[model samples]
Target: MSIDLKTIKHISKLSRISVDEKRAEKLAGDLNSIFDFIEKLNELKTDNVEPLTSVAETTLKLRPDEVKSKNIREQIVKNSPQDNEDYFVVPKVIE
Candidate 1:
């Protein structure tokens, strides 16, 4: 697709950017170049090519899931200023 000054102005307005006529012309040229490059890339045949998720072939190492500590809620809750059997009580700040 071709990019003109009008298109550049419209894009600048939508993006909340201010652009002068000279800058707008430059942007139009730059956008046209980018679109041309994309068009060239689209012309390449890739029907047999597979999509790659990662460049590396190695699988991620995972650690075994196991409990490392006993239930310590009662011991920890003893240090709190105010706590019930299962929760900590805090001052109400909101209505």
Candidate 2:
């Protein structure tokens, strides 16, 4: 399928984009060339080609799920605007 000037104009109007006749013609040609390239690719025989699962051959190594936080409670609590001994003091929103 190829894109025409009329199709480009309609698309521009539907997308609320302003395209002049000169620019619309250029866009139509560019889109037509892209479609032509896709058509050429479709003509190629890929009957024996294996579908790609991943770019890399190796599987990702996953680490065991575990808590890794070091004891930094005092450091974090220092940044709180109003702090209790071991909790955050915020304006109570719920009744």
Candidate 3:
């Protein structure tokens, strides 16, 4: 799609931006150049290309998940401002 001066003016007003006549014309030209580049890219043929995460092949290292600490609820609750039987209590944060 082509960008016109009227469209740029409307967009500037909606975004609370002040663009004088010269800047508005300049922006329209820049936007038209961007659209022209996109149109050129659309002429390419890529039917057999595979999407890639990276240009090179590699493996991600991972560690085994294991429980390493015993439950210490009572000791932790001692430092809190308030606590019930097995939980710590704090002020409500959301409405």
Model 2, position 69, has a per-residue lDDT of: 87
* Candidate 3 ranges beyond 4 A from true positions: 54-57, 83-85
Clashes of each: 0, 0, 0
Q: What local lDDT score does residue 44 receive in model 2, on the 0 to 100 scale? A: 97
lDDT agreement with native, every candidate: 0.91, 0.90, 0.91
Candidate 3: how many backbone clashes? 0
lDDT per residue as tens, model 2, 1-95: 97988899899999999999999989999999999999999999999999889878788899999987889888888877797679777778999
Candidate 3 RMSD to the real structure: 2.5
Worst 10 residues of 2 by lDDT: 83-92
Query: Residue-wise lDDT of candidate 1 within 27-91, one digit each (tens)?
Result: 99999999999999999999999988899978999999998879988988887778678777777
Q: Pick the winner on TM-score between candidates 1 and 2.
A: 1
lDDT for position 24 in model 3 = 100
* Top candidate, metric TM-score: 1
Name the runs in model 1 displaced over 4 angstroms. Answer: 74-82, 90-95
Q: List the residue pairs that clash in candidate 3.
A: none
- lDDT value, candidate 3, whole model: 0.91
